[model samples]
Target: APAPTPTSTPTSTPTPPSHAGRVLLPHPDFRLFLAIDPRHGEVSRAMRNRGVEIFLLPPSLHDPDLISSSSPSSLSSSASSVGNGTATTATTATTTTTPNTPNTSTPPPPFHEEVRLLASQGLFGSSRRLRAAVVAAHARLAAACVRVHKRPPDLRELAHFAQLASTLACRGWPALAALVVAWRQIYLRSLGLGGADMVVGLRVLAQMVREAGVGSTLGVAG
Candidate 1:
C-alpha cells in the first residue's frame, strides 16, 4: 500500500473535429435557359453534373408572339369584314398577286457565321452562358455523330466552341473557358494551356472531331 500507485485514471482521447459536408451550389452569377422536355434530359443532366443549375425556359420562349393587340374598333371591323366575306376576297387577291412578288425571306446565316457573330457580340462573355452553349453544341455533335456516322456539316464551327468549353469545364475551371474562346477568336489558335492541359484539351477535341468525322473542319486541329 505504501506507494499503492495512485490508480491512474485513464484520460479519454479527444474526438477529432467533425466537418460537415459542403453542399456545392451552382454558380450564382450565371443563368442558363434550357427547354424543359425529355429530349433535353441528357443535356440537363450533364449541366447539373458540372454544378450548373438548369433554368427551364418554357417552349414559348422559342415562339415569339405574332399577334399584336388590337383596339376594340379594329377587332370589330375585322370580325365584320370576315362576316361579309371580305377576308376571302382579300385572300383571293393575295393569291393572284403572290407569284409576282420575289421570295424575300432571307435564309439564316450558316451555323459557323452565327457562332462567329455571337462570339463577336460578346454573347459568350460569361462562363455560364458559354458553358450552356457548349453543352448544346456538344449534344448536337453527338447526335450528328450517331445519325450520320460522320461529323455533320453544322458541327464544324459550333462544335469547336463546345469542345473548348467542355475541355475547360472538365478541368473544374469555368473561368478559363471564356479565356480560351477569346484566345481562339483573337489569335486563331488554341491557347497554350500548359503541357498537361494542352494535351488533354487537344485529345478531347480530337475525340470529338473523330466521332463526328469533322476532321480539319473543326478548326481545332491547328
Candidate 2:
C-alpha cells in the first residue's frame, strides 16, 4: 500500500497589541515592607544602596492620600535647606505643607477602573503596539525583579502585583505603582501570595511601601 502525501501551510503567529504611552516610573519613591527574616536584610540594604529607600514604621501610622501641594518658591526654599539631595528634597518639599484646605473638589482614581482597563488589554502586547504604559512598565519591573529577588515569580503573581500597582495609582501614586510592579515582578513570584491570609498580608505590605515614600512621608529612607 502507498500513502498519500499531505500538503502543509505556514501561518504567522499573532502579535499582541502595543501599549500606548503612559507614565511608567513617574520617579516616585519605592517602599518594601514585610517582616524580613534576618536572612533578607541584605536585600533591604541593597535597595538602599541603589537609592531605593526602606522604612520600618508601625501599622498605626498609615496614610497615603495626605499629599499637600506647595508653591514652587516655597518648595525651592525647603529644598535648599535640605541641600543638594534633590531626590530626597523633592518628596519632602512636595508633601511638607499642611493641607489647611482639604481638596474635596476632585475625586481620586479608583482601583476597579484601572483594572478594567488592564483586563481589556491582553496581559502583554506585541512590541509595536503594546498595552498601556503601566503594563509595559510592569513587564520591565517584573524582568528586573527576576534578576534581584531571591526567587523568580510567575505571571499570576505578577498580575497580583499589577493590581497593587493600580491601587497605588488610584492614590495619585503612579510612580509607587510602577515601582511595586517592578519589585513584585522581580521578587514576589515564587513567594506566592498563598491564600486569603497572604492577600491580607500583601495589602498591608503595599500600604507600607506606599507611605515609605518621601512625598507622602516626611523623608526618604536614606
Q: List lDDT for all candidates, in order.
A: 0.34, 0.36
Report the C-alpha lDDT of model 1 over 1-222, residue by residue, as the tens digit: 476666789999987568756678878787666544321234645676866554543342232221111111112122211234443221101112254322212111223333333333222323222323333333333333334343332435454554454444434554444435633542133333344333433443433222222211121111
Candidate 2 lDDT by residue in tens digits, 19-85? 6565577445765455443212345566557664445443322323211221111222323212356
* Candidate 1 clash pair list: 151-212
Q: In model 1, where is the ten-residue run with the lowest total lDDT?
A: 66-75
Best by lDDT: 2
**Listing every candidate in turn, what is its Cα RMSD in Å to the true structure after a full C-alpha superposition?**
19.4, 24.4
Candidate 1 segments whose C-alpha is farther than 4 A from its true place = 1-155, 181-187, 190-222
The numbered model that scores best in TM-score is 2
lDDT of 2 at 33: 56
RMSD of 1: 19.4
